[model samples]
Target: MPDSVSPPRTIIVTGGAGFIGSALVRHLVAHTAHEVVTLDKLTYAGDERALAEVAAHPRHHFERVDICDGEALRAAFVRREPDAVFHLAAESHVDRSIEAPAEFVQTNIAGTATLLDVIREWIDGPYAAARSDFRLVHVSTDEVYGSLPLESETRFDEGTAYDPHSPYAASKAASDHLVRAWAHTYGLPAILTHSTNNYGPWQYPEKLIPVVVLRALAGESIPVYGEGANVRDWMHVDDHVRALVAVLERGRLGRTYDIGARGELTNLSVVRDICWLLNELVPAGSGGSYERLITFVDDRPGHDLRYATDPGRAERELGWRAEIPWDEGLRATVQWFVDHRAWSVERLRRR
Candidate 1:
């Protein structure tokens, strides 16, 4: 680890109550000196209880506002006078995007535009005179690169051309472009990071890993789309959070970095692994094992076959790399959800 500086004195983290956002908030409060202001609309995907660990901290503040609300975002920006921003708010589910692309466009695109506009104005109007070092770190996904071929050895780099396959990825691609434009056109310092699939504690159960874990624990059929050959590079949320903080502190403005574990596993393999672990940890019924619950389901519309990322730039430039091994991370994640079953059940009931 590099020498640590005193944490950011004041930072704004949009979507700070969500899975990865909450992890980042916990990290900042527990490990650093940053006074964090979490601005979240508290969408179903976001739960304030996730941040209960640091909710009582005098330095931690929460604002209930949507990024799409331009006037509200502007007011928050002015009031907070944030020295840095970690923009993580978005409509992120690919399957949900297929059902309703409009929401994805509105939140990921329009909302990002609104936030950028506010940041641009804030930089030019008030903060310009001070000329302090500031950065806006925009968190995005590797899905914007579309799919990688099953046999391909190459991984997505920061230079990979945009080839979004789903509405969600397309919306994120649009937001990525807007962030870059704000940096280039208006000189607003910004950095973008595209990370592979993240698995860890506090994940919404709708996501694949969590869904599989929960359904298997309940003895429900675990759905596998298509042949379950879709491949995803999995990064633990903690590692990704660390990379995001690194980008905010050290990355060059207007540059994009890719953060991933390079631990690729097929969907079927991942499901089976989870089942096997569950069988050992929480034995199944007398008649069957958790793996027996696997059921093939129709593939999602426009499902990307594979996604992988090369984190070389992030490693070389930011001095960051994924530390947790995949199996260890997966085990920890499964144990977390198992231990927090009530939390997951309550969240699903709310949905």
Candidate 2:
């Protein structure tokens, strides 16, 4: 809603079937006049149901393609002839990356490089006429900046140095570097963004909020990694998508923006909050609380102590600020999981 009044144009959104990507696609189709071409591999996490609302829209198109498949990506590019690209496809889960670093390397790093190559070719060849107006938004995570001390008052800024601790973070860091390299070395009109933890409806159960909500509802022991003290800045998925659109439309090329809502909470505290909400919404029998099922598990290797970003840059440059309050968003998300129990259960089983 932050002044994205651009003319209707074909915009290619890679990984548009994933959680954040699907949200972005839905917002574009619902609000803007731009035509969207979604290119996704439809991995387990990438579900077409996420985009059900816009699936039948005339301006919305879906193409089954992986970012790593150069020939397939090239074909999509030539066929779509997009005026801009929003690259969101990647292997995103940290735990999965720890179990299988090779997959993360290939998808997050190599796949990004492949997409950058195609964008570069398009800017210089088939899309030469619109080269100056073309934009490539490379979405990334704040974990690439590594951890901040739990007590530190400082937040990650645009100038933060990369110190990725986990395989997923490292892979994204590599991709962020690739996007910048293409922009600087090849003169591509590209911008990068780093956002905080995102949670909302349609989120895969592998994430914290959904897992806590589902496990609590089923009366299962809620597993909390470590002391559940790791802190993260939470931004509602809606707020994050709005920021992304603002950045894509008005952000300066070759620059980076950090997006966050300043909703900081420790892992344990978040689970407790969800339990309380469930107890209030759907109380358990015998007047027992959901917190009784809390179980602390082994901490993940190299888990960051904290992650918070200073959204001052985005606020000033793009006139964007997160509008959703933490408590309100959490309640809404909890209710969403409760209402959509089937989807949550299926995702939990798949995980």
Candidate with top lDDT is 2
Q: By TM-score, how accurate is candidate 2?
A: 0.98
Against the true structure, what is every candidate's RMSD? 1.3, 1.1
| lDDT measured at residue 290 in model 2 versus the true structure, 0 to 100 | 93
* Tens-digit lDDT track of model 2 for 1-351: 543598888998888999999999999998898999999998878889999999999999999999999999999999999998888898888999999999899999999999999998988999998899999999999999999999889899989999999999999999999998888899989999999999988888888888888888888999999999999999999999999899888899899999999888999999999999999999988849999999999998888999999999999999899999988999999999999999877866765
Query: How would you encode candidate 1's per-residue C-alpha lDDT over 200-303 as one tens digit per residue?
Result: 99998899988998898887899999999999999999999989888877898889999999989999999999998898888876946799999999998888
After superposition, the stretches of candidate 1 with alpha carbons farther than 4 Å from their true spots are 1-3
RMSD of 2: 1.1
The reply for model 2, stretches above 4 Å from the true place, is: 1-3
Please give each candidate's TM-score. 0.97, 0.98
